[model samples]
Target: MTKYRLFTPGPVEIPERVLAAMAKTDVHHRTKEFMQIFSSTAEKFRQLVDSEHSPLFLACTGTGALEAALINSAQEGELCLYVSAGKFGERWGKIARRAGIEGVPIEANWGDSPALSKVRETCAAHPEAKVFCIQHCETSTGVLHPIEEIIPMVREECPSALIIVDSISSITTSSLSQRKLGIDILICAAQKALQLPPGLTILGLSNRAAERIQEGSPHSLYFDLKHELKNQAEGSSSWTPAIAHILGLGEVCQMIEEEGLDHMIERHNRLSKLCRFGLTQLGCTPVAEEYPANSLTPATPPEGIDAEVLRKKLQNTFHVLIAGGQDHWSGKYFRVGHMGSFSEADMRMFLGVLYDALSEMEAKLPEKAEFETSLCSFV
Candidate 1:
C-alpha cells in the first residue's frame, strides 16, 4: 500500500510514540491498571482545556459530545440559540432540532464571522434561550469564530445561558480555555489536534453544566452524560472504552506537556500561515481571510477550476490527501489541515507535492523559484 500523508482535517498524522503506545497489551477496563491510566489521562485533558471540572470522556466522536451537551442542557419547552458561520456550526442547530429542542438561528455566510453586535442583538431578542451553541473553529471553512468577544456579549444578555462550544478541531491548535473563557461545555475529539485516532471524544464541562446534567434525565442511553460522569468518577467508562485510543492519548498528552501547549499552538499558527502563503502563490485565495483558523486553511481555486478535481489529482499522483469543500462550497474550494504532529519539514514536503501537482495540471501558479524561496522562510 502506498503511504499517503494526510493534509486533510481530522485524523492528522500521529506521532510515532503515540502510535507505539497503542500497541501495549490491553488491560481490562475494570482493572486498577486501566483506572490509573484513565485518571492520569483525564487530568491531562483538564489541563489542556484549563478546566477545573474533570471532563467527561465518551466512547464516540465529537458529534456525540455535541448531542450530549444539547440533551443534557436544553429542555423541550426551552429555547436553544445557535450561531452558525459554517457547516459544523450549523450542525449544532441540526442536532438540537433532532433532540426535540427549539433552536433560534443566528446564521452567517460561510467564511464570515457573525458580528458581535448582531449576536448580542440575537441574544437580546431570544432572552428565553437557555442554551447557546457556538464553534471555536468551523472546520468546513477554516473560520475561527471570536468566542472570547462573543461570550461576553452573550452573557450580558443571557447571564444564565449554558454556552456550549464545539472545539473539535481547535482545542490544541488554537487558544481555547473552557474555564478562562467561561464556556459551560466544550467538545473535542482525539483525532484532531490531540494526535490520536478516532473513537474517543473528550468533553470539558463546567460545574454549572455538571449541575444541569445531574438535575436532568438523559434523552439517550448511549450518550447519557450523567451515567458517563458516574462511570468516569469511578475511573471507567459507562461502556467498554477504546483502550488503544486512550493509551495513545496518554502518550500524546505527554508529548504535549513536553513540548508545552503554548509551543504547540505556535507551531499550528506558523503552519497555517505557511499554508495560506503557499496556496496564494498557487493562485488560490484563502476562504477565511479575516479570521482563518490555525488548525486548517480553506483555499478557493481560481474560477472555472474545480477544486475537487485538483484534490483528486494531488492524491492520485503525489499521494497527498487534501480535502475538498463540503455542503454548498463543495467542488469550489480545497482545505489543507496543519494541526497535530505536522512538522515544518512535513509541511514543506506537502507544499512541494502540491506545487508539483499543480505544475503538472498546467494551473496558473507563481514562478516556481519565487514560490519555493518564499516557502523556505516558514520552514
Candidate 2:
C-alpha cells in the first residue's frame, strides 16, 4: 500500500484520533447523545474564533455555506459588495450573482491585498449595499487579507452593511476575533485548518446578521438561516446533518483546546516562515510575499520548470500531495499547506523530498541557507 501526506490547502491531513472518532457508531441526529455532542462542538467552534455566539453547522461543503450566507441575508437584486484578491475572494461575487443578488466587485491583483482606501471608497460609492463580503485569507494566493484593518474601515464607511468573511482556510490557522473584528457573518469549513473532512461547514452569525436574515426573503427552503436557527435551538438541523463529521469535529476541537489557540497560531506562523524560506532556497518565488498567510504558501517555479509537473512528480514519486494553483494561475504555481496537525519535522521531510524531486526534474536550484536570519525574523 502507498502512503501519502496531503499538503493541499484543503482536506488536510487529519489526525489518527479524529479519523477514529469519525468511525464511531452513527447516532440519530435528534437523539440525546447526538444533541450533546452537537451542542458541545458548536460551543467549541465559537470559542475557536472567539465569538460571542455559537456558529451554526451546515451539512455541506464550504461553498454551500458561502451560498447560504448570501441567499439567507442578501436579497435578490440588492447591492452586495465583494472584495476579490484571489480565486476564493472572486468566488464570493460569483456566488452572490448566482443567488440573484446584485454583486459589486472590488478586485486586487493576484497575490495582492486590497488597499484599505479602496475598500473605504467602495463603501462610500455603494452606500446602499446590503452585504460586504471578503476573505480572511485568500487560499489560492496565500494572501492573508487583514480583516482586523479592513473590518473597522468597512464598519465606519458602511455602518449599515453586514460584513461577511470567508475564513475557511484561515480560521484555526490564524487568529480571528469575530466580535472584535465586527464581522456579521463568518464562514468556516472542517476540511481546512480544522483538520476534519469536507462534509461540514460551520458559520457564525452575529446578532445583527441574524436579524437581517429574518428580515430578508430568500424564497429558498434548504438554506433559510432563520429556519436553521430554529432547528438548532432544539439541537438539530433543518435537514439531516453530517453525524459522523460532527463527532470528528468534537475530537478536533478537543485537540485544539489541548494545544491552546495561542500556541497553535504561533506554530502556524513559524511554519509559514520556514516554508517561505525553504521555497526561496529552492529557486521558487512565493506569492503574497508581503502578507504571507500561515495556512499555505503558493510558489511559482522559475522559468522553464512546469509547476504542475513538479507537483505530480512529488506526488507520484514521493507520495507527497501538494496543491497546484487554480483559475488563471493553473500550471503556473503550486501551494504547500502547512496548517493543521503539521510540525517542523514534517516540513523538513517535505522540503527534502521536494528538493530531490526538483533535482530529478533538472530544475535550477539555489544554494540552501542556514535559515537563521529567517528564524530570527519570526521572533
Error of 2 at 336 (Å): 0.6
Q: What is the lDDT of candidate 1?
A: 0.87
Number of clashes recorded per candidate: 0, 0
Which 10-residue span in candidate 1 carries the lowest summed lDDT?
370-379
Would you list the clashing residue pairs of candidate 2?
none
lDDT of prediction 2: 0.86
Tens-digit lDDT track of model 1 for 1-379: 9898899898888888988999888577889999989988999889888886898888888888888888899877678998888888888888877878898888889999988889999999987778999989999999999899999888889887999999999988998888889999999898889888889988898999899888877578888778888889889988998888889888988898899999999999988888888777778889888888999999987656788998999889888898999988899989999899887888888888888887887887778888889887655
* Cα lDDT tens digits for candidate 2, 1-379: 7888998898898899999999987578888989888888888788878776668999999889988998887887888889888888888888887788999888899899988889889988988888899888898899999889888877877778899999999987888889888889999988999898898998997888888877878867888888888778678888999999999999988998899988999999888988888778778899897788999999998668899999999989999999998988999999999999999878877887888888888887653344333433543
lDDT of all predictions, in order shown?
A: 0.87, 0.86
The true-structure Cα RMSD of candidate 1 reads: 1.3
Query: How does residue 164 of candidate 1 score in lDDT?
Result: 93
After the best TM-score superposition of candidate 1, give how far the Cα of residue 353 lies from its true spot, in angstroms.
Answer: 1.2
